[model samples]
Target: MSLPYFHHTPETASNFAQNLRENSVEYVRFELPDLAGLSRGKTVPMNHVESYTLNGLNLYGGAVTLDSASIPIQGTGYNEDINFADCLMVPDPDTVSNVPWLANTARVICDTKWYDGRPQPAAPRTVLKNILSLAAQMGYGVKMGHEYEFYVVDAATRKPLYTGQPIFVTSLLHQHPALDKLMRVLNLSGVDMITANGEYGPSQWELNFAAMDGIAAADRAFVFKNTVKEFLHTEGLLATFMTKPYKGLAGSCSHFHISLYELASGRNVFLDAADKDGMSPIMKQFTAGILEHAAAAQAIWNPTPNCYRRIRPHTFAPSNVSWGVEDRSASVRIKASKDKRQHLEVRVPSALSNPYLTAAATIAAGLLGMQHESVLAPERSGLKEADDSFKKLPTEMHESLAALEADTDFIHMLGSEFVHVFQTVKTAEILRLREDIPAAETNEYFDLY
Candidate 1:
């Protein structure tokens, strides 16, 4: 297959636009992620792509600093007073790709800017890029892969796509024509889907991606989720990455498998030869740093109030800050692997997490560990569900926010400006939900507790 048109520089962006014009592509969408990991952006005609690519289009800064419901926090300057102005959206040509399900259209993820060409720190994508920038400066590379367990249901009836006892990794259960179509669309849109299978609940699916660099991996995840939602809708089905969709069924998780490498040597720094379960000193320090800040980082890993509902026992959604060799129930799991494959699996983050912030928080914490040469606690073996003695990670949004508030040093690691806005917005969401509890209360949820 021929290479896609280039977009890494201004000249390349202009050339890419010309290529799109030659192909008669109609509209191009400039996609950006909000704090909720939801796509929000503007669509422009082919004639306007070049101008927007260079000068950028203005958008609501609140698009990056708001609650999951898109409500603006009072202090983020994204409110009615400022009219959510003063931000520019610049498309990354390197991220441009064709939209398989949408007719005559292509899309590119964008970065936010202030009028002065400064990075928009409150932007989740910006937050992540800032961390990646530091890693690049330090001659280190961060790599990650995401595994999202999600559910598909009928659009009209709002239940599982298939009815019957769900089985894990059963080929028969994954034979739906729509799933084949979904996979094709994802691959066509530049998503390298590693593997996919049926999970333990009705209509539930787990899909994995090959490990990629920090920022690019997040972009890949954004496209993966976007394609799944669009393809499911096109197939007359509704799919949700909501952490917990039902009362008794196992909740889905968006787990991240992560590792780091030495940029110069191109070696997987997370592991070493003859290392026990890949538990090198650097790896242990990274795990220690993540564990130390796990409570505070929960503000991003499990951002929404609905997130905590999924942390039930025996579900593989860990509720504690623990590590173990090949233990799926530990919050940070050191997977058993060959020397090159040594890495960690972060189990707490869910499918609905904002990819940018999730990447930002995880990398920031790990870097802090390396900076301080933090020590990993003794590794626990076996599963936590089988034993209830493990120290629990914060299980509630308020608790996580409180931990964030108390850890001023950790908050400073990602910039105080961004952390302050994030905390305020999330806390406001909790208060608003509490106020709505009486009217919104149902069988599954009551009082936003």
Candidate 2:
């Protein structure tokens, strides 16, 4: 297949407009990443693409400053109210694709920034960029793939009726006619979907995408979520990425498989055939770093309260900070590959986590390990049976926040100002969750997701 055209400058946007107009494109979807690491955007007429390309589009400043509930925290002192901050959404031309579900509809992922040219601190894309810079300085390039799981429900009835059983089943319970339509839309939108299968939860489905660099991978994730929601809503179905949508069912997770490559020779640096475990010394250090900082990084990987429910033990969910080969029970599982292409799959992250932040934190933590020459012990074969001797991830949101607060090393890596702002906003979310409902009801409601 031909590579999708990517536009990096205003001139490219102008030229792309000609092609879009020639193809009878009616609408251009402006996709932006929000603070919660979700995709939110507007669709404009194709004719207006040039104007937005030249001057950039205006978005509410609250997009980056608000919490998951869209509430503005006054303590952060970023924005006074739910006021729209003037920011520029620059279309990433390379990310443009046509939407097949809607005739003449096209989509483009964008980068958000302040009008003065500074990046929004809470921007997931920018966060990934910062981590990538750190990785580059360490003489390695990070490549990652995302395995996203979610559920689709009837929008009108809000009933989970798609995949019938509470776990992966042979037959789909109520296959909506819109499923095919959504798939077509994603295909046309240039999302490289490897497979879509029933997940271990009611109405839950998982989608896998080809791995790419940090920024590109995160961009694809944002686009994929946006396309799913937009296309499903048009078909009267609601698509949710909420971490644990249903109780008693397997919670949806967004698993990431990360690997590092040599910058100069473009060689996969993680592979070592002579080593009994097939991981190089550098690879061990990287894994050590991730394990060491896994607790502190929970705020970025498992950001929400509901996310905690997915980290329990003996359910294929990772509760301990351990690494093993092909062991699904561990937080970090080393996957077997032919060569340097081998990498570690981090299994503990929830679907609700911000892709940019999660990817950034993983890269930063791994780089830290490399800097310290940390060594990961021999890979354990059976992580499920491993006792509590292994460090476990925080089981509650508040605990995770406290862990983040205590880990000065990881906090320093994320930068003081950004970490402070993130902590304040997240603390407010936990409090809101407490006030919104009783603990039991909250757990039940989230479990039914």
Best-fitting candidate, measured by lDDT? 1
TM-scores of the models, in the order given: 0.93, 0.90
What TM-score does structure 2 among the candidates reach? 0.90
Candidate 1: stretches off by over 4 Å = 1-13, 22-24, 81-83, 169-172, 386-389, 438-449
How does model 2 fare in lDDT?
A: 0.78
Instruction: Go through the candidates in order and give each one's C-alpha lDDT.
Output: 0.81, 0.78
> Weakest 10 consecutive residues, lDDT, candidate 1?
1-10
- Model 1, position 411: C-alpha lDDT score: 85
* lDDT, model 1: 0.81
Candidate 1 lDDT over 1-449, as tens digits, reads 01111124678668868888886788999989888888899999888888877777788766777677777778765666577675778887668788988888999888887776667677777778778878777788888988888899989999787755466646655667888888888888888877878887788888777778868899998888888887889899988999887878878888888888888987988886677565778888888898889999988899888899987667788888788887887888887685788889889898889877888888889989989999886765567556677667788889999999998768877888788788888888898888774433564575455
Give residue 33's error in model 1 in angstroms.
Answer: 0.6
